[model samples]
Target: MQSNRGTPLTPSQAASPHAAAVADSSVTRSASQQALILAGVCIAVLVLPLNFGGAAVSAPTIGTALRGSPVAINWILNAFMLSFGSSLMVAGALADLLGRKRVFAVGVALFAATSLGISAAPSLVWVDFLRALQGIAAALVLAGSSAALAQEFDGHGRARAFSMLGTTFGVGLALGPLLAGFLTQTFGWRSFFLADAAIGLTGFALGVPKLRESYDPHANGLDWPGAISFTAALTLFTFGLLQGPESGWSSPLIVALFVGAAVMAIAFVWIEGRVTRPMLDLSLFRYPRFVGVQVLPLATAFCYVTLLLVLPTRFIGIEGHTAIGAGLMMVSLSAPMLFVPLTAAHLTRWMSAGVISAIGLVIAAIGMLWFSGIGFDASATVLAIPLFVIGVGAGLPWGLMDGLSVSVVPKERAGMATGIFSTTRVAGEGMTLAVASAILAVLTRLRLADALPGSPDASAHAVTEAAQRVATGDLAHAAAFLPALGQPVLVHAYDGAFRVLLHMLVAITLASAIMVLGFLGRTPSPTSRDPASPTLS
Candidate 1:
């Protein structure tokens, strides 16, 4: 029988053979629907993080193979983040307006096609183009599929479903580094894309047909003007950050981009207020739970997600660890995600989820500080403890975020809620990743400005070039540019920049902990999953 919490049952319940077919057909049907969602989403969860963690590990190799510059190297990663992050809000709202099954199928199909194209691309330009395109597909998959999963489960079941989601994400991340290392070392980085295509298509084939169509009856057509303005704002701001260091922060072009981004952001907010059906409902931000949920992903973006890119490159490119070795080292960072999220979920019975999240952030802050103390001199064994600690802290909020996202809002608005929270998480990651790269480059340049032996103008240009290469883990190229002192000087300069980055992360994590606790600590936790429930209480 269907539970009192209203677990969705399949229409074709009579087809199920479980529980003697006649008895509790609803139970069998509910099982079937949950199985479909879990299968599809689990497949997607596996492949998506592979692209993230695997691709980061593959970056230095890709740069060397493609003969890419520092700008080119960073863009390969940021292009995906920018396009994927900025598009999520619209994708979520789109799912609510259109059919969730339709959006999801299109996303997975597009993913397979793009992965194929990326694998065959001969240049960084083509690769970057495809990666950005892939982000759009990723946005669709995340929004459509996650919302579908949210629709099928409720109460304890809903919590469990999302916990599984977090755990699957962890599995992918944990495995991504090692898998990327092996593929890049043996078959080449391009093979990783080949793997993505195969796994994604298999998931598509298995899961799409099982998912039923869903749409919010109350949703009007998408607010196109708001969508466009929001995307433009995000794209412009990210581009400005990426271009600032190289173009001169005050360059007319960079300055214009920042100004345009600010104008567009304001326009988006204005348009949302006036629209009868806004793409992003501005009214949702009034609720503290809504704001608190958003902060969870944003914090993870800084403390955990950025490291997925930063550390892989640092280990393989500068520290001289093999791709496989770096992968093994990263397992410490990725493993907690596998188990800690469930532990966090179970803990909610005794403690407020908000308090749990706050404690986790504190732990992550401590890990970041411990991590920063180590230099290139440290071994993988020495690095493991800190990496594991960081992962443990991040996993707590990761476990609860998806479940809380749906519980805080009306059931009909799951898609929009998913989008807003995801957009903040990803857009923040992309923009922060861009900003962090630029800041590191600038800091590295300043450190080397006086050390180079050339005349003022020549030295200025050399330092700038050297810093770019150093920031991307291209030490050989950087050494070539600065012949006076070689690799040691480059390594020393990078360490200084990295230290500053760690300090920023620690400070931000601590503040985020405080912000989230204040916003959500008093809010009641959801005890029973109500299909139509809006607030946790």
Candidate 2:
């Protein structure tokens, strides 16, 4: 029997078979729509991180046209990373207080606009400024998108959602170089940014309307003091490391910057603890599982992100591979990410997320160590094997780490947890890039001093120019600036510096693996179905 609009009916009367079927169909449609909305979010994420890999491949050309110094060129990448990492927690907090959909829409619009600004930039300074703005835009999008997904899905569904996101991220990073190569080689580096702007606008048009708003009711207060301290600490810390190689490490200014960074870091912790609502939840770190999930991303970023930039640069500068060609070479590093993330759930059934991540790190360390042994004379075929192994290692832990991070947190705090995870990863990348560049610079100087015997001042000046050119990934061009006698030495020096850098990465990755294993405790045997916890399914 049909119920009148104002009348209540018993269960059997209320749910006739036809009515039940109709209700089920309606639910199916809603679920489909929700999945489509998640797809849009993934599309945006996939396109965003592309900027780094694409820019890394094309940076030499940009540096050459702009006549930028090595430091300025590195800053092109560092500036965006630094601002993104610093602003992530604040953006997350804002999303949880305001509206996620509103913040996300704003982020998409801002990203599109700033990308255009970057494309039209007249100098490195303009580019850096616009890139920094884009980073903030990206932070807003990341926090909003991930929080929305976490709220909508749970258990296996949430894991699937995160895996899809990770897969798209991998696809974007993998294809970025290829796109950058095609655009930059055909038109110019500016074309890459223009492409990004167009993609951002398109993503905004499709995504914003379908996204539902989600926020934490209890999450109040902006926590400006904590935000300021955190940002200042990372900025100052990165500044010191970046400057240390150029100016003496013990220089008064560098020392002061380091000291200021330390002070700000302590202040951030103090402010967060006392605040009514903290930007970072200090209590999350006390949970070993949460700590493990967070630390894995850092280790992944430290071990893998540098290779994304460094390898393309190496190929272009030393081997004279076209930008596109270098990007193709990176397929060995990016392609495995595609398959592994999609099947991460299957792997987790056999081992804990921590065990899988540690194993992946160990594999990556082996790949880096293998690459370290191959000198400049090695063929691309020789390089491909190690690069392939590294790609596999990186892929194994990709989505699993992201899922585990939020799985351990309450749904309400997903934005905050994601913010912390993204912050740690990018922050690690920024600091590691700075240190790696410093190592490259110092090594270049030492090598040049031995090779070019003359007035100390003259040799020092030559070393600086050569290092700048090398940093641009234009080694063949660098030869034009160096004396014929020193050209070989410069090439060999760049090679040696890269080897040492890889070794350093290997050491860091191994250390991270050990920590992960220690914190992970034990996993259920393959035959056992572990009971679902509130944090993890």
The lDDT for every candidate, in the order shown, is 0.76, 0.69
What TM-score does model 1 achieve against the real structure?
0.89
RMSD of 1: 6.1
Q: Which tens-of-lDDT digit does each residue in 63-102 have in candidate 1?
A: 8788887888898889888888777767766665575667
What TM-score does each of the candidates earn? Answer: 0.89, 0.86
Model 2 TM-score, all chains together: 0.86
Winner by lDDT = 1
Residue pairs with backbone overlap in model 2: 407-535
For 273-301, candidate 2 gives per-residue lDDT tens digits of 89766767677687676787766777877
Please list the residue runs of candidate 1 whose C-alpha ends up more than 4 Å from where it truly belongs after superposition.
1-37, 150-163, 217-220, 406-415, 453-455, 526-537
Worst 10 residues of 1 by lDDT: 12-21
